[model samples]
Target: MMQEWRRRRQAKRVKPGDGSPLPRFRWWQLLSRSLFTLELVGPDGRPSSYAVDVRQAGDKDDGEVRARLYVDGALRMVSRVPARFPVPGGEIEVVVGGFGMKRCHLVAADGSERQLVPHPRSAEGRRARFDRDHPVASRGVGALSLLAVLVGLCLALPALAETISEIPPVAQAVGTFKSPLNLPGWLLVTVGVAAVVGSIERALRLRSSWIDDLAS
Candidate 1:
């Protein structure tokens, strides 16, 4: 029953797409756009293809990013992220993070899920290729991203606590506080930048935790 409500809510977000053709991904759009494709067989055993495209750096006047769904190479549906489009056997879900996409997968009715294949020219594809070609280096990079998020959290929590403790009412109740890890202003800024970079790296791999996302 709850799942049905969720499906209905997600379905309402979808709007009919213009009868326009899908755009070709270009080299310059690698940083701004993401495209992924899924292949499946219908119940009748007919093969069908679907594509999910997102423009991360696009305008957010509507207060959210949008994901466009294409069926058999024609535009079919579009919805704001985190989007869920009902398909043959399940739904195509798209979610976003601070820097880019954090999730893009097909969720089956039986609760199984699989990520879609990214376009070969896209950044995600290149990153995946890097993982295949240099597993050790890729793992090292992933480790660094996690480390960066942890360090950022360590740096952020104390600062946040100190700020809250400094408030007049809070100070009166709990006394003033200072973060022990205070370096310089410039260093704090540098760490913040690193955290953002780490968040982006994690998103490329479709990995993020609430804590890491909050810290970044």
Candidate 2:
């Protein structure tokens, strides 16, 4: 007798799914922290109509619940539903309960009704994933690097220009010291070549150090 009574009680609370009288569900406090998402769709199944995300909001097991709804890129509404209740179902028109309910509906060619529940993560998650996969916004860093290179070249141009015009004093002395045998020019040329080679070696070491900085 007790088993039969319990069965009857259970049957009273859940939807029959056969087009019988639908049961009215009492709002149960949902554990907001539980991560459950719902998706609602239109008649063609290609368009999204609504979404519900469940998450914990506070110290109690029943945390505050918030949902974000969008139509195109614009936000349509933000609302809260009682935890533990299956979010309402129906086409856009049937489900939208006035100002508070985010509604979705579908009418078949035969005039039958198709109900859809919104997926909470569809549009929201897609936007986040797209941002992660595409790094176009980070191109600003590359642009700044190019600008820095240009500025450094500008500052260095003056030194390069000066080097082109001014002959080394040592070179002038060697010109004066040249003999009919040209021995002075030969010795000065050998010394100048050695000096240039040394300067090149020092420059290579400095370039290696600068490369190390870039790596770090």
Clashes of each: 0, 18
Candidate 2 per-residue lDDT, tens place, 52-126, comes to: 332324334445344333333334443343211222342122221111222233334455654333222333233
Which lDDT values do the candidates have, in the order given?
0.87, 0.33
lDDT, residue 160, model 2: 43
Per-candidate TM equals 0.90, 0.19
Give per-residue lDDT, candidate 2, residue 195. 37
lDDT of 1 by residue, 49-128 (tens): 89999999755676457999998889999998779988899889998877788889999999999999989899888888
Those runs of model 2 whose alpha carbons end farther than 4 Å from true positions after fitting are: 1-49, 58-63, 83-216
Deviating ranges (above 4 Å) for candidate 1? 1-7, 59-64, 166-176
Error of 1 at 118 (Å): 1.1
TM-score of 1: 0.90
